[model samples]
Target chain A: MSNTTALPISALHERVEAIFRKAGLNAIQSGALARVITAGERDACKSHGIYRIEGTLRTVKAGKVKPDAVPELVLQEGSAIVRVNAKCGFANPAFELGVPALADRARACGLAALVINDCTHFSALWPEVEALTEQGLAGLVMCPSYSTVAPTGGNKPLLGTNPIAFGWPRMGKSPYVFDFATSVAARGEIELHRRAGKPLPEGWAIDADGNPTTDPEAALAGAMLPFGGHKGSAIGTMVELLAGIMIGDLTSPEVLEYLGTTTLAPPHGELILAFSPQAFSAGRPGDPFARAETLFEQIAGQGARLPSQRRYAARARSEAEGIVLTAAEIEQLDRLLALGLDAVS
Target chain B: MSNTTALPISALHERVEAIFRKAGLNAIQSGALARVITAGERDACKSHGIYRIEGTLRTVKAGKVKPDAVPELVLQEGSAIVRVNAKCGFANPAFELGVPALADRARACGLAALVINDCTHFSALWPEVEALTEQGLAGLVMCPSYSTVAPTGGNKPLLGTNPIAFGWPRMGKSPYVFDFATSVAARGEIELHRRAGKPLPEGWAIDADGNPTTDPEAALAGAMLPFGGHKGSAIGTMVELLAGIMIGDLTSPEVLEYLGTTTLAPPHGELILAFSPQAFSAGRPGDPFARAETLFEQIAGQGARLPSQRRYAARARSEAEGIVLTAAEIEQLDRLLALGLDAVS
Candidate 1:
């Protein structure tokens, strides 16, 4: 038998959705979660793909997230803010519920913000931003995770690996997009190194005694450092202020305290801002989309790769050739579909 | 003779305003410019203080900026975007003219953006964000300067240093604020290194041929690197897109092409976003400001320094003891006020 089995993207989505539904997730939650996970697999972003299914089930088993959440959208007259209360469910569904209104508000206001509160978040932000680009709008997305990274110059973990993502629409091409954690390295990277018994590169983390260290174990026990020293640290702090407190949601430390462990998905709030290029560039000379092409050309002409190129390329391939899953992955999926929540622990 | 002279902040502002007025700037432009420059000096940020006045006059003398042009505000009913057409003047006055309307719109809409177009921008962004903080709002400001930094993995200068600034209001204290260039090192830092006969730092810049170089002169002839590698580069690129192309203003490369030299200030548009915490945290559990204070205390408890602390400390001293200027600086100010635009080549 072949070591790998190929499945169409739609087929994989159905399987994932089945597993979530079997685990008692509501239709909205299961569908949205499966879609994001399937998109992750299609883009060759394995970290967020099927690998995340177990964690999702574990969180469900632990009762950290509501299995049947019905998100409610709140739209105010003459306001540029679109809000969605997730009712303690997964953030994906809340985001899905809010995006259309967010798009409408952005079109009307030139720029608008979508705030999703009281949600369990565990997916990459790129999908949220990518959705805006699909609607011909530029978008930025941010949210706080569980606290795991230290502010620069601090000895303990107080800041999360708060991720920031940005997307810009292009002319019949993949939108320019980038999503990255403010920390020097993700906690998973350190965890992988610890499992492999490898040492971390310098500057990634500090020891428990507040000294720099290379040992992955010590670094994991201590704290990961913010990227680019003070500059990245400041950006992370801004994320806490804007996406956390400003949104009236739980900050990273609060999420950690609520969950009591890093294994569970974080319950917090997310901020997504959308901008209508047509509205902003209405009186301007050049078409914003065409002008953006020129900028990308200059960047690529000089041999610099645009962000999200790799993921887009993988997406194209996956669409054409189907996503290939290893036999072990197939077995894992089968077990998940068969056992549901009982499969996790 | 004493090497330095102490002057009240108001006195310094008057002297600076007088210099601009003599240089042929309109009353609005001169007054706004003087206030920002004086604020810089009061905070001990010498780079943007009196040191920048000469450059402003140089830009004026070169006919790159309008000295006497008046900025006009353009407001559309029910829109969150408050625009100011700089009328080819300095950005300071345009920003000053739009801030009040911006604040009002933010309060009404929960969030708002102020766009200043067609201006010569040289002053630091902190003052702009700080102005929003003074109104009890959180603010974010960004603008594109001349292209001097290279996109990561690219050999040539294709992006600006692209500074980003953010400020959050605090109760009974200076706002939490940070402003920084996306580049690993500012162009001035490289020029200073060259003047001091010091080699450039590693990872700071690339030679004209695209290879890394520690020689300051070679680096100056080449391109500076973005901080935090690809992440910073993505942010710098985003600035060019949102603050530049999206706003229908000049991008970094376009600014460089228009000016043909980095010595002259770049004329571009700016984007300022203001968010209302009261509107955002309407029915949330804890007070956002108090929660932010908790976050700050946790950071400080771990021995981490908050951004802008030093500047705030200096500001307190300047307010209490008056601002002190070096004798040489005083003489320069006198010469500029006396000679006006004729002082520059």
Candidate 2:
């Protein structure tokens, strides 16, 4: 077991921002990156939080990801569709430009869709979706990555554990957010278990031969299973075509074949949709936000819990008591701090 | 075992059309209904074929579904966003108005989305999607219906076995079409088994208490399972929100609780999205369809067959020879044919 320590949210954000600054990211990029990373930690999404810092930093160091790059609007028409040439690393600029643009279009068209190709990995899609809900729009987002999974009953990895997220604005509470990968388990989870020397749960992964296995090491060397079997496989496959092929990027299988080839580019594609409530019920007198609140209250009254309830609860607790960090993670931070000092030498 | 007979596609279509006409449908509506039904039969999708005729006719007779209603575009903005009232049923007018509207919008916005609410049941969605591909647009469609499925690990049905479909254009061949329900097994499949006096395959359904069962009757009395278990369940749940709740319609629980209420309305919603190749690659500069065809061919050449290959092959055979109907189905049709004579009396 690792020891735990508490740090104020603001303090953690400042520290992260400082590190990014030292790593040569511009002020705006560092600020945005800090905010995204802190939000993930507060939401208890450890897999997408600071755990990704090292990998991101390495990409930056290799000049493979540009922190200062701004995304360009490739196409736009009415309030229905928009396309972005995502020149920056995926997370910050995408949130800065894509979400607001799509929401604006939705406001005008009553429905809007944005497709962004050539974007790097965007962390914890829920934040981006929630941002749309803040603008009183419903959001649905899907991102397809390079293949990290095999089709159900197949021996070779042929798709990514592509993630899909949707957010619906509710009345007085946070929007109902649902975000998950199509795989039985995510690659991060397998890595976490491997690092901790723990076994994986059944149905989470398969070996190279397509036989189930609980060994994390074997799982890393093989493929993650699609959650729910064939249906999950189908969903993941659909995401590949919708977000990848539709965007004119590499399909899932092509991404797999190009994996680990430094000469090959990162897999990329994202689709975001926003909907305005006015389109469906034009003259309903009630405020949509109020109606949303009433509906959530009714469901809660019936003891039917909404998804994202726990995440919000976790955020509240973290705000009150400060964020908790494992001793191992803190040690890694200390190592990074030392690296900062060594860099000056 | 039941005897079966082969009938030419045109004959089957005509017979089905006659039944609809006798049931009070106008010429265009009856023709549309007949074509979709016959197409299902030709593709061996018995569940969505003639088997649905009786239920559909009852809906029309009860005045719950409009027979001659034509969908009207209530809103359109820059060809990127559209709202179709679906004044009649979902399949016919939606195909007639929704696809063309979406394609035009996609051309303007690079992407387009259409929402069709207040529509009646639409049979297999693949054909409608294929229509979009024929217009040189990528199609993604989803429809959520009244509750016919229980949540994973839950007893009460809280969602429809919602289906999703996608179509991608290829050169010199038919478009790649994929359509499937989010359920482990469609309700129609279980109903078919019950009619044939056969046990259902395991893992397809659960009883009222949420325990697995293979009895078709029990499965019907219970709820169908989502495909791939939790992952499929998640997708189905997303569809319920995206196509149903987001459209401001009745949710699954609400529909179930108010099923027999005088104010009850159809609990179904659909979302159709279109993406222009120009949006991603600035049109077919080097033959986009040809490129897509080559990509798929190369993949298949490497033994990676695309989904829906077998279904398309079967459809071709049926068209070339004739559609086959079981003895029970033929008897049902004959009984319906006799109804026309009785109506004249």
Candidate 3:
């Protein structure tokens, strides 16, 4: 692959599929994993895209995740709340099978929840949330990962850089979506800055001794701070309670301690909630999408850039002009492809 | 009432109850409203405590809110999602009526939502969420007020402080709960700082020209900043979508624009979501409360204070030692009690 050569989404997806297939994943698993990674790439999320492939492959080979594992329905709360046990497999496939059921159930019940437990969730949560939003429903997703952040005014890392995602449906336009980690700076982002030899902004992290520092290296060696201080830490705790306790999976810190850095894609948990506007808003005369669009316009009129606006802009630009990875990145991809995982090549 | 006198919770409740009863509320309504206000005062929440009595009186006097109005069930989606129309009255009464019903329904359905519309929510949201929490359910409450905070990167006020409250149930312990505004500093806090001749904190609010300022007066005249910039703004938007659009009530900016500083409450909306732990977590061997306690301990071990820990400490001290109101607060209470509307007084 040439550094200047633009790869279509289809091309990247195929390459990723080939890699997964080489790692013994079935077509369904390969396809599901490829779809998320491709979207990450298409949206210029390099950290979650090409950067994750090697780790995922290593996990699959090490038997930390069952490549052939299938998700099973464990419980149902009325017709609205459904729980799926992912059985120590990758989460994307479980979500693929569960989200449609979630949407259909929400349409009938007005609100629905798909609680997925015991899965290794290595991808961004926005794709599943946006899927619900694109179906003209409001979506909210919560997930807790390995512990990496210290609580407010505390030195030890006691919580994950938990991520929460939200999506609102819009008719004839892209759904409004946002996904963010609870930490002031995601560990991956700090690592990225360190790789690029860039100085971090203040208030992002602290030194190993718990003193605030602007050095990304020092912060990574120590612990990341929660965004917005105490408030963000509280939200992170809420995420752990909802996705961990509610779903009957190990909380973030518990997972890290349970695994002890020996595994990848170990059983974690996630929760996806969807709401149907039609069933709830009997008093509204116009479409709910129109109302949501009006609110979006109100913010836009204030000259504020919304999350979806930035994402869509980047996505559109990437889809048309293609993403440009560095020379080193292309070489790394080539090396990964040559690691006995490219039977087709 | 002497300013120097330390008042018991029962005494404060009695006075608040008398004021509400005098203003035409029935015993049930007066009791519910007094309970919340007393909690605020006991917790040292000066912003929502005695300070709000004047505004509540003004709203009642101006006919913006009907003191005698009652909330009635308007819509239900199976047993899980319910909507209540407040008949243009205060929200505390509506929650007082709906929460018991909500808890019952949530236990049956595993999850339930109570949407309140056509109401003036003049008090803190924590009370209603705490109600559901006490019943061994996870509670989430969302309420959007008149626009007072600016969208990130935009100077104009396009969203309210928009507090979202969450509570996690713990058996035989104070349920962990927190309520936070999307804005870094709420409007009422800025007013308090201005009155005390105190400087505003950095990153709290911007001047009229959208420039960051430490002067409380300048920030008060301008728009308040969201707590975590774009992230906070997005959360505020989520609250509006869930509370306003889904509940068929006016969104934040729309409400402020329609009222134009002419009214109090102005027919706001709120959404309360409750989830039953037993229904969601089938695999847990022991009580979910035990797991929750462990998580709380983990944080405490890290020297991180959880929300309920702090609140319960304050509540205990207040109950034992009582609270002392300032001379100005006492005078304001005196005037409020002497108003012509005070029939009970």
Candidate 4:
């Protein structure tokens, strides 16, 4: 893992796209995958960015994920409920197609719910929700991952550190976004710590015997704790029910098969909700966008940092000065580039 | 405080109504107050039931709550957004009037949000959501109380252990209702332990210095832990933002001024959401009610207990025989009965 000098984001995206294209991804699919990976890095989500390249490539090679598959829309209930059978993975055509339709339905219905099943892994939710808000629609998205944590007081892991993201539209300011895993800490964080040979924070995980453990390896062998304890457990349970059971995918037992295991294969189910304030309100006669902006400004002034502020700030920095990547991560990118991968195709 | 023997449910309601009437509540207001209190006990929510009578009387006497106040409807948009101002106290009337209208709007708009502000405590949210489901609508309700618990890793209590309830209508069965407080344990549980001289459960509360304590009395002097830790905290925080700030109520700090130091009085904000399944689907042609019943039976067979099963069961028992009350609680009822209150009108 020798360090390599940083490269411009464009260069990185091109290289990543080229790699996917080399692996037989069509131009559109490669471009979509590259955009998602690059966005993760731009937002400082290193674990979800190029760090995932090796695993993703392995999945592609193993045929666990299709490189050029398109999502099929199964059911549409006008602006209320839309179901998309992700023929491939979540990040490719599934997200690209489902998001815009969800936004349109939200505009028509005031609130819209989209179910994405059998889709590939969606790395970061913020970009999707943020994109919705940018289109004047508030977004709430949740995805139940492979089970990696136990219910409170339960010895066996039964639920994923399910993540939820909410984005609120603003007028002049960036949309307010809140996104976090339902666990005390995401399993990815534990995995990262394990990679770096670091101990986990107290209360974040429990060992095989259900005793608290700081050793990332031990936690990986055991279960992560819920975020707030019972409340978090309840939410995790709710997510399992809503995002998993409700969407017709793996239940508690089935999800457990993927625990402590890493693969680029798509998780089975994800739920997305998009809402339009105008659908519920008399469309912003006085500029609702301005009102939203004022609300965020007021919240920030009151010492409350809006969720996603840090990510948005990072994105701005990346756009201005280019994305920052570790030398090692850059080397990995270089290796892929030298292999003649054309990400953008 | 001395223990009062239990009495029949009818007697308890009569006593509570008498107390409110004597305290200057109008007939309808007294009846509504009695209904909520009696329902709390009926549903096994002892904390929100008869226990709140004395506190309510004191607040009314002190002019802290308006006994005869009425909520004013402020705005209505396609039933998607309905706003109500709780003149001063009286949350019941607003709930009674606004919920049905919102449900109807949801029937038309697919989803609806009802925001109520500046109201005295509205106890036991399950009943309200159940009522919405009875009208064939799904409901999600959230209430953010005044600050009662500190944020995780923060000493000062900065947020309320907000509660949220969700109810979905089944095709043929009782609506699935899930109602829970965001705290590790309800505030009432702590009070119960304090009165009974019992140790609280581990992980339920933390002392003033943020150390876990099982001593109820010490916990009373300290802070309740968020349910699931950070996950529950996140939900509570979301409730505060959605039901409190977004709905235009005073923040936790301003709300604390109105609620007393004890767990007795809490100034809180409540938000109710209603969604119509019919709006999503024309639903099968005939027997919409029958469809719900069938759905419930199937779910029940699958080991899914309907939310608020206890309440429904108790209601059935009360309807067939009579509502049961503890001897001590009954004695308290008799004391109130001595005021010569009329059960109806």
- Pick the DockQ winner: 1
TM-score of each: 0.99, 0.89, 0.94, 0.78
Report residue B189 deviation for candidate 2 (angstroms).
Answer: 2.8
Docking class of 3: medium
- Tens digits of per-residue lDDT for model 3, B50-84: 76776777777767777888789754547467777
Better candidate number, 1 or 2, judged by lDDT: 1
lDDT of 1 at B18: 99
lDDT of each: 0.94, 0.71, 0.81, 0.68
Candidate 1: tens digits of C-alpha lDDT, residues A127-188: 99999999999999999998888898899888999999999998688899999999998899
Candidate 4 structure, TM-score to reference: 0.78
Q: Which scores greater on TM-score, model 3 or model 4?
A: 3
Task: Give the candidates in order of DockQ, highest first.
Answer: 1, 3, 2, 4
Candidate that beats the other on TM-score, 2 or 4, i.e. the better one: 2
- CA-only RMSD, every prediction: 0.8, 3.9, 2.8, 5.9
Question: Candidate 2, B136: how far from true, in Å?
Answer: 1.8
Off by over 4 Å in 1: none
Q: How well does candidate 2 score on lDDT at residue A251?
A: 62
DockQ-wise, the better of 1 and 3 is: 1
lDDT at A57, model 3:
79
Tens digit of per-residue lDDT, candidate 4, span B179-231: 88887787778988999999998988888776789999888778887776554
Interface RMSD of the candidates, in order: 0.7, 4.1, 1.6, 6.4
